[model samples]
Target chain A: MIEVRGISKRYGNLQAVDNLSITIEKGHIFGLLGPNGAGKSTTISMMCGLINPDQGQVLLNGNAPGIKETKHKIGLIPQSIALYEELTALDNLSFFADLYNLPASQKAERMEWSLAFVGLQDRAKDAVQDFSGGMKRRLNLAASLLHDPEFIFMDEPTAGVDPQSRNKLFESVFELKALGKTIIYTTHYMEEAEKLCDRVGVVDKGQLLALGTVDELIEQYGGESRVHIKSEQGEESFMTANPVNDLMTRLKGLTTVENLSLQRPNLETVFLNLTGKQLRD
Target chain B: MMKAVVALMKKDLKLLFKDKMAVFFTFIFPLLFAFFFGSIFSSSGGSQGLKIAVSDRDQTEKSQAFIGQLKEASEFRVTETDEANAKKLVRTGKQVAFIILPEGFGENYGGIFSGQPPEILVGIDPARKAEAGYLEGSLMKLGIKRFELAFSDANEMIKQLDFSIEDIQQSDDMPAEWKSLLGDYLPKFKELTELEIAKQPEGSDSSGLSFGSDGDNPMMPLKITKEEITVQKTGPRNSFSITIPQGVIWAIMGCVIGFAISLVREKTLGTLDRLAIAPISRTQILAGKALGCFAAQAMVVTLLFTIAYFMLGVRFDLIKLVLAVLAAGICFVGFMMFFASITKTEQSVAGMTNAFLIIMGMIGGAMIPLFAMPGWMQSISHISPVKWAILAFEGAIWRDFTYIEMMTPLTILTAIGVVTFFIGTRMLKLKQS
Candidate 1:
């Protein structure tokens, strides 16, 4: 289990992360969603012990993040493709594995397994600078899994990745869950989180405004469904709690309607509703 | 934990090798600096000896003997020519300087005991003033040989003694008491030498008094011989030995600058951030980075010295050189870390580190030789690590410094390393995400 309780962080005058809180159980995926300055990376950095919280605490199964045991079981897949481009894939993995102090006996096995998991085993000998963007992304993922830590933090893993690679990453996340690993994933792609996360937290202006399972969050903050019709009067749309009943009753007198459609609320709708439509830098 | 640090070093080293510019600057560039500067400062003529021209206008027995002596000295490449030709040679820079034995030089060659000093004129360009001094000194040394030989023969010594008696008797510059004293003693000395020669058995060799062959000249007083004193082994065979340290320091500085920018690059590339989350403390991460730079510096120093010793006639004490390399390593690694701390971007680190090193190199006597700098600038070199680093290397290579003497430079380098590293690490620890 991982717990972030009333954690807050400030940089000069900016409140980068407010007193936000979340808990993740073992063998589950928790999505941290936010705008550019919503403090998603800052929260992940705090959780990974890369940055210290000014107030409150983060505990990985009651062990503070920076403690040996906590750090030993934690891995952070930074959003950027954080890798030594001049080094071959195997070399990069070997270096990171040594840092984690994985047993020498298991180093080769874990390295080989991690590479295979990310589908980069064949390119292990190639320098990362020669790899495609998607391949580097996969190698980046492979690097994080070398130690097989129980708690993995993937901060925008699909960022700038092709769809095929994104799907591959999604599959890898699912596979991580099946392997009984807890994952804290952050991304701007709502659909990705909608597909992968068991729970999602929506934050804006350094504050967590909503946190729940995908369906629950949508039901709680996704606003309403919409019904649309094109008639002799003109095209018209209306929001309703029940699109089926509202569509049937509101469109009964529309004789010359050429098109009809219903819009159902989803995570994107829930995200926009909770964070507002204003753009953030 | 050690393994982790080693791993980081290996990665950093691998990256360095992959960088062609770094390899060239670290290894090849220093060698070039040493070679080019060494050739210029070391005896420029190398095996051809010091080039000089001789214009023997006297054309007399003593003048011929002086010229012969000059030719026999293998250290000089003597050129015999007329005064006009010798002047042209010097003016055109074909020769360092010219020795002109003036018309009356033969008669006045033995002028040491107060006939006028012979004017063995030197025709040289004023720009060659230092070389002209060398030419005059050499000529003077050769001119004294015939005078020294006069004592080995009774007739020659008696003649010289008689002339000296007359010269003193007629001299106005001599104090009255001195002239009176020498006027009385020279005759007595001459009479004693004549009597001694007459006492020798008939048909004895022309050397009236022989201490036998290959012995000190009993007649000659106050013989001075030159010797070279170094701390241990034969020191600096040539200028190459002196300039090798200069080149090595620059290469080491190159390594420092390269690693400083590398650290900043890692930051922007996000690898540093990734490593920060590892179970290791921030110190270990920094240690790993520093170790890599240190290793690079060591490699550069070793490579340069090895090449120098095998090919360039340079020599060094291996143990002392190792001490020097280690001290320099620590010092520059601190520089790398400190520069990395203050510079946030790769461009900033590159620009700032390079500018700082170049300035330090200038003021430190690495880029510019200390002797060539103004007195105040030379004094300022004391504060630059570049000066100390070069001094440390010189101590090991040719200065033949004792262990105690080596401490002066090694301590300074290490102190710089420790202070800067401590401050830099403190700043790094305070870095926010």
Candidate 2:
């Protein structure tokens, strides 16, 4: 279990993370969604204990995030490559495993298991310098898992990764969740959040704007989805505010409208409608 | 805590080995310096030769003898030249000294020995003053010998004059035998003086009276020898050997600079932030980093030792040599750690550390030997870590100190390392803000 309360972080005069509160139960994937510079990374950094919140406290199972005894209970995967590039995959895994205070006798086993989990067992002997971007990302993820922590904080874990690698990351997150682990995942990709998160928190300008399931958010801000019709020769044109029933009636009435499509707003539209801004910038 | 420390050490080792340029600079370059410096320092031409010039003014048997003495000295090269040429040669740095013998030098003491000091002017170039001084001393000794022989011959000539007994007894200042001789020889002396004065009619008044007024006969047969002996010192004792060892100190300083870069790299790559979140205290992380750096530098020092032994013959007892190297390692590691904690960027760290190393080398005896430096400068060198490190190494090798004799330098080195380590760790702890 992870709990953050009234967390606020100030970088000089700018509030990077405003006073906010959230809780993540065990065995669930919680998504932290935001646009660029929305304090998503700041909040995750605080959760990972890499930064001290100016006016709040974070607890891991009722203990401080980085308390000596509680440190082994959580794992952190940063946005950047954190493993030593010169070290082989096996070497990198073994080092992180040792950091968890794993016994010497168990380190080899843990390293092998972690590498196998990331599907990098064959490339374990090769240096990380030779690994592809996705492979390195997988290895970075594996480094965090070596300690087998109960809860993990991942900051844009799929950013810049290939689709295949991203899918693998999602599968791994689910696998960890299935094993009764808790995950706090931060990302700008709405589809990833919609697919993986049991619940999502939408943050912007260092403040939480909304928090609920994808369906719940759609119901709150969702309006009548419409379909548009157009003709090449300007013979006919039409707009249907209620697309479900009106689509068939309009198509039946307008035989000249050759190109017609329904526009059910995706997450990008949902974000724009709610915030009156593009999701990307 | 121990686990995290090990993890940090392992990570640093991995990164260092991965960097080919870093490996080359930290390990290979120092060996090159050691071989190069050692070969020059241990060369056989410690004090090879000296340049000397001989001014043969008298052109007599005695002058030829003095020139021959200079020529026979293998260490000195005697050049035959006159006073004008000798002075120009010494001034132009072609010769270290010139021996000048004045005119009529051999004839001034033909009869009675009157201790008329033969003045041989030895002109020495100030740049080669010591070498010239050595030659001057040798020439003075030879001149004395020749003058004594001339005096002996003059004594025999006085005996042959044979003065009247009444005139010799009547001379108040004359001893009994010399009085009898002077009384008998007064007319001969007067005749001899007149003849000696007549030989120089143009300037006889000035020359003869100067001799006569000093109670000395100018007719004495004396041999004047002139030899311009210039001594020029040559070999590794010259400028090159002195200047390059100072460069070796800078090379050692480069090791510290390299380690500081490692810290900056850690910061840039976000490894430092990652380590901070691990279950380790800041002090432990700093300790791990410093120890890893010390180990790397110590390995380099060992490589330098081997190179010096095989190529430069820098001899030392293995135990004492290792001890001295250990002391240097401690000081360098501490210095780099402290430097790294204060600096934020790789460029800053590199620039600052290199400048610091050079400054330390300059202040320390590594760049300038303490004996050659001014008093205040020597006192200021004590604060530089390289000063203690160089002193420790030279003490063991050049001073031939036993292990017990190395207490001061070793203690000072350890103390500095400890204090720097403490301060650096404190800085690291405050970095979380």
User: lDDT (CA) for every model shown?
Assistant: 0.85, 0.73
C-alpha lDDT of residue B106 in model 1? 75
Tens digits of per-residue lDDT for model 1 on B363-429?
8878676656888887889989998888888888777899999999999999999989988888888
lDDT of 1 by residue, A1-281 (tens): 98999999998999999999999998999998876778999999999888899998999998899887788888889989999999899999999999998888899999999999999888999999999999999998898888888999999888889999988989999999999999999987788778999999988778998999999998998888888888888988889888888788877887778888888888778867765663232
DockQ, each predicted model: 0.56, 0.54
Candidate 2 local lDDT, B131-151, one digit each (tens): 866776666666555545533
TM per candidate comes to 0.79, 0.79
Clashes of 1: 0
Least accurate 10 contiguous residues by lDDT in model 1 chain A: A272-281
Cα lDDT tens digits, model 2, A1-281, are 88889899999888999997898888889999889899999999898788889999999889987788777777888888887788888887877776667888788887888888889999999999899888988998888887788888888988789989888888888888898999999989989889999888888889987778777766665555666677645534444346778777656655476676676655666677778887788
Once superposed on the true structure, which residue ranges of model 1 sit more than 4 Å away at CA?
Answer: A224-226, A231-234, A254-256, A265-281, B31-127, B138-234, B237-251, B299-318, B358-378
Candidate 1, residue B56: lDDT? 86
